[model samples]
Target: MHWSTLVDAVVVAHQPHSADPARYDIVLGAGVRSEESLFDLPAAPRFELFAGTTVAAASAGRCSAVDGLFKPRADPAPVPMELIGCEPAEPLLAALRRPRRSERNWVHLLVLDRHGAEMASRTVGLAITGARPSVLGGTLIDITLTDGGDERPSLAARPIWAQWYQGPPAEPNLWAPYDTQGRAAWLDLTTRAWRVPAPRPDRSGGEHHLDGRFVTDVPGLHCAIAEALLGPGRYFGREWNAFKDCLCGGFGVAPPFTLTWHDAEIARRALADVVEDQEDGLSYFEDIVRLLERYGVTVVLR
Candidate 1:
């Protein structure tokens, strides 16, 4: 479970608000597992609920326990990182020297397997306000990620999750063993997975079987569907809208085929309480089947 082979480099780029982002001059080479800090999230703080009591203490009715309004996520701290053997360009140097909040930069870290094929693309806000020469003959830059925007704490995941990024397991049902928290982290990384593998020449139509044994939650369903359509460690969609985009062709497979969902009762019960659309009143599982049907895919829920 060597991690050095898990990542190739952090490709930095400037993203304009109006235009698409392109590659910038700086590329931060990956260091050993110990030197990498991009995924090193800080420990989450513990929250304490306060109990309130009145001085009178004679009322049998009115109980007052104030609701805690603690902030879910604080701004992540700056992580010190060293890029090996890369010289900064004038624009990057200028931005570092005179940092501006309005300008946007992104650090896209490409995860690779032992064979050098890309497995995922992890991104963070690149706020490099200072830099200095490093002993490794490279530039040491300060990296501070912006807010997660989804209220999740921008923290590091367990090493096991990182180890899993080496590649998808050789067998199917790769994501079935993880607990709820572990599955959430796995789904997070799955959403970041970019299709860098050589695309299949025929991404048009195919019959795919979905193993619904692990579709315990919405994210798990996404993970399962991606593996079903594409392959393990692949990404088909994140939410319903993105799933729609995938079904519209060019995302590994087109519609007009059959999908036999084996062990479908698992997902049906798991997602029975969840709803993707209120108007239809269909559960998440049913909505997914309905969406697939709309796209001309015959779904046989076994």
Candidate 2:
């Protein structure tokens, strides 16, 4: 079926490179109604280590700093889904009859908006584990879905996902005053907004002014920087390491540009409350300004 046929479909199975590029619908409503698992991501594993005797000292009421490590990506858990009133095409039915570990069984599960636009998508290896009769008068299929790619948004960030599902906003700084988690979610959404990499940095060395009134925290700083560099609700990076990667290329605006920051004093005091990376020995604002200078950006502070 054509892609447009699946508009407003609760769940869709898409095959992009197939001869017909079919998008099959996985209808909702009936016996299965709980959808909390669809929005949750798996917990990440973190390892923490302390110096010898540090643990003992901590037990004795002495404080000691510990080193922590985490992977960039987490191993995702399988999504248990129950589909009611699903009518599969012949090809999809044949594949589901004897599900195996094959490319044909791997499909993108798209979550659609009320208007039938894609809100979010995930690749999953689908297998029909069992089938039963729905009490409401239909077939109920139990499907076990293993993660093929893309982590789901965290619960803290689901509000942003819900907002974007309606479509992109028309204004800037909508994320202002939201705690760091919300602002971080805003940046994450920006990363997925475009299919291709961001355009090359502007070589004309144009002047981009930043409104620093809302730069109160680390993630807020990132949000302000994104809008300053790429316009409203755009993304440059979400963290310091990612920021550096954006500077090298692909995130719009190279060095030799001028950035005039307005209301800089607000961030100077507000960012002081944000404590991170004590080993860096510099405030968040200072570090950002220094990095910009190092990369050939002419920063004018007001």
Candidate 3:
């Protein structure tokens, strides 16, 4: 029935060329949903790469294909991703380099069945990439699951997103205007999220971030993001408002935002007056942090 494959265990290690790739060095083990051996089975099944946490990968990078997605890192001819294995069953691990952040990476190493069919196509979670217990003092580590189990996983889930649109928005990613006729069009999006950046450039009137909390991104950074994405009306426009509205919530969808460590660090070190003001009725920023967490969105550094 099956050509039977070889190689029982799956492993990912830093490529020989990686010396300083301590942070980028990654490891992976494979598991199937059907609880079958991956070693010497079918000839060649397909594979892909995606996310555990939403922010770094595409789902975490770009949920809304039409509206707004993160800036693409195109210069590096081969960006790290969906790295398919060579054979259906004998492919070995290759070196994958990524950012040095401490975020956990939930990778889907989907292995397909031999006939290019789905009945036996398996989606496996190479769940060993992130925040697991320390092993080998390696900056990046991967391990096999002690208790064998079947694995089925789809890609990219960002900060927990609550899609509340009554109808689909004219665009993707941003909140939909109304709930679709039925809840089928949208994937209930993975606000599968988590949290950004800095500074105290004073305007004498106000600040982009105030007292250990972000009122918003710095004007310059905002300008950069806006200019790059919004263009024409960099200062104000429907697109800009939609971005803020998506985070601010209440109109329809809830605020689909989360703060990262780099973000909170800036808040904590903000001017004391800004961090906690006596005259301004306790920074609402603290409240926002708590709210994000309440939604199961972790407010921590990635």
- Top-lDDT structure, candidate number: 2
Model 3: weakest 10-residue lDDT segment is 188-197
Q: Measured by C-alpha RMSD in angstroms, how accurate is candidate 3?
A: 23.9
Tens-digit lDDT string for candidate 2 (1-302): 10001122242232343333452222222222222323322254232322111112111111122111111335456555555555545655676666674434666666555566555576665666654454446444333443434455567777887877776555778888578888888887777664344356355488988889898888888888878877876778887778877887766667778888889888878876443345454666877888889988899998
lDDT (10s digit) by residue, model 1, range 94-209: 66665665247655655566656564555654555345564555454433333222223233345435556566555667667776566666666666455555666546556788
Ranking by TM-score: 2, 1, 3
Question: Better model by lDDT, 1 or 3?
Answer: 1
Q: List the residue pairs that clash in candidate 1.
A: 41-156
Error of 3 at 301 (Å): 3.6
Best by TM-score: 2
Could you tell me every candidate's TM-score relative to the true structure?
Answer: 0.55, 0.60, 0.18
| lDDT tens digits, residue span 50-147, model 3 | 33211222221211111111123344232122222223121122312322221233333432224222111233333223223234444433334221
Stretches of candidate 1 exceeding 4 Å from the true structure: 1-156, 159-161, 191-194, 203-206
Model 2, TM vs. native: 0.60
How much lDDT does each candidate structure score? 0.60, 0.62, 0.28
Worst 10 residues of 1 by lDDT: 48-57
